[model samples]
Target: MTPDNFIQNQKQQSSTPYPYPYPPPFSGPQPVHFSQYTPPVADSSILSHIMHSISSIDSRLSKLESMDKKLDKFDGLCEAVDSLFTRVKTSESDVKKTHYSISNIKLDELNAEKDNLWIAQASGGSGSPGKGSKLKKEIAEIHKQNSELKSTVSDLNLVIRPSLAHGCAVWLPSSASSQQIL
Candidate 1:
């Protein structure tokens, strides 16, 4: 049969509509079976359903990608907070250590001053009359200086101890220190 007759017979035999004008061209002289031909049927509902499913899956994938980005940002924020917390703790510890060291040094100085006062008092009584008066004046000046030092230390403790307890750093200028003393 001719190609046109074969195409017509295939069209007549199959109930479904053919997309192409005729079947694929063959190179060899093969016997054509038009009666046995079955045209492909495209169901619109099934195609639409598949397209919808693909779109929904694409949207879901996009959402998952965005959530992953948010999680990464949250992780970075957590690390920053942890780093800041560690730094604050270290600074607090250093401040406390420095305060203790200063207190110890001040106490040592006071003790030394007290010992010197005792020595001066002991020698003052045995000195010559003129020298004894001079020693008294010197001893009185030393006592005044010691009292001033004690007051200054007390003021520093008052300002610093509360700030330390609250985990705050306190810086007092020379002017501010004088104002606080008053």
Candidate 2:
């Protein structure tokens, strides 16, 4: 016979009630031979086989449920990370506003410094007004703290970058849109 005909004959003989990736549908009462006369399959053997199949199906279903639960937990964690990023951004904005207002106050103090020279001289050549000096120190401290916070937030982005990349992969098989991360 030609190869095509032989292959077609093989296909016809291999009967299955379900599509690929699914188990073939179970047929009832398969005959088993133990002697020349061909005795029927023992009841105990049939019961054991059925039990084994049922156990396998149950385990697979249980594993599927466990995976679903883990995905839910991962989703919740991603939301929490997104919220934390939002809070950090809000705090950064607040700090920026405070820094701007403080800078304005320092500018006013600088303008007033020329006028305060007489007071400084009156106090035995101290050369600096007490209140102006105090304001300068405060402004310097604020600038230092703001710079530190900015650097910290920038560092946090470094850590978040790789985590977000991996998390997107776990949540979506296809490439996710850019808006999803933000």
Candidate 3:
């Protein structure tokens, strides 16, 4: 039989009322079937529905790709913030250590000055008053310097806190040390 006759016979069989109903037409991309290829003429509404579905899927895929790119950017920003946080912590530690050492040194100096004052006052030795006076002056100067150092450190800590928290400033160890002008 010719190809046309065969196709016509197939159409007739599909139209007949059989015990089992025929499968509905494909609304998606047509699949290649048999040696003789023929495009299935589907309903226009089915064609529109298929086209709309394909476009909707394409749009969703593009949106997912865009979200992935944004996620990468957000991850990079988080890493940068985390590194800055580490640096700020290190800087605060350094500041605290320096303050502690200075406090210890000041305490030692004050103790020594107390001893000198006591020794000068105990004995009626020559130049005793002069030595005591000098020691007092030195002690006073050390106290003044200590207070100033504390103030400076407090100011630096305050400044560093906001700058680091805001993520606008990145503190390298070397640079942070240099900026600690106390």
State TM-scores per candidate: 0.42, 0.39, 0.46
Q: TM-score-based ranking, best first?
A: 3, 1, 2
Q: In terms of lDDT, which candidate is strongest?
A: 1
Q: Write the per-residue lDDT of candidate 2 for residues 76-101, one digit (tens) a residue.
A: 99999999999999999999999999
lDDT at position 115, candidate 3: 80
The global C-alpha lDDT for each of the candidates, from Candidate 1 onward, is 0.79, 0.73, 0.77
Of candidates 2 and 1, the better by lDDT: 1
What lDDT tens digits, residue by residue, belong to model 3 across residues 1-182? 99788767777777564322456666876668734678778999999999999999999999999999999999999999999999999999999999999999999999998787677655523537566567677888999999977876776787778777776753434323553322
TM-score of model 1 relative to the true fold? 0.42
lDDT of 1 by residue, 86-176 (tens): 9999999999999999999999999998787666655764434456567788889999999978887788888888877787666664635
Query: Which pairs clash (backbone N, Cα, C closer than 3 Å) in model 2?
Result: none
Q: Model 1: residues >4 Å from true position, as ranges?
A: 1-39, 120-182
- C-alpha lDDT of residue 95 in model 2: 100
Worst lDDT 10-window in candidate 2: 169-178
Off by over 4 Å in 2: 1-46, 118-182
Candidate 1 structure lDDT: 0.79
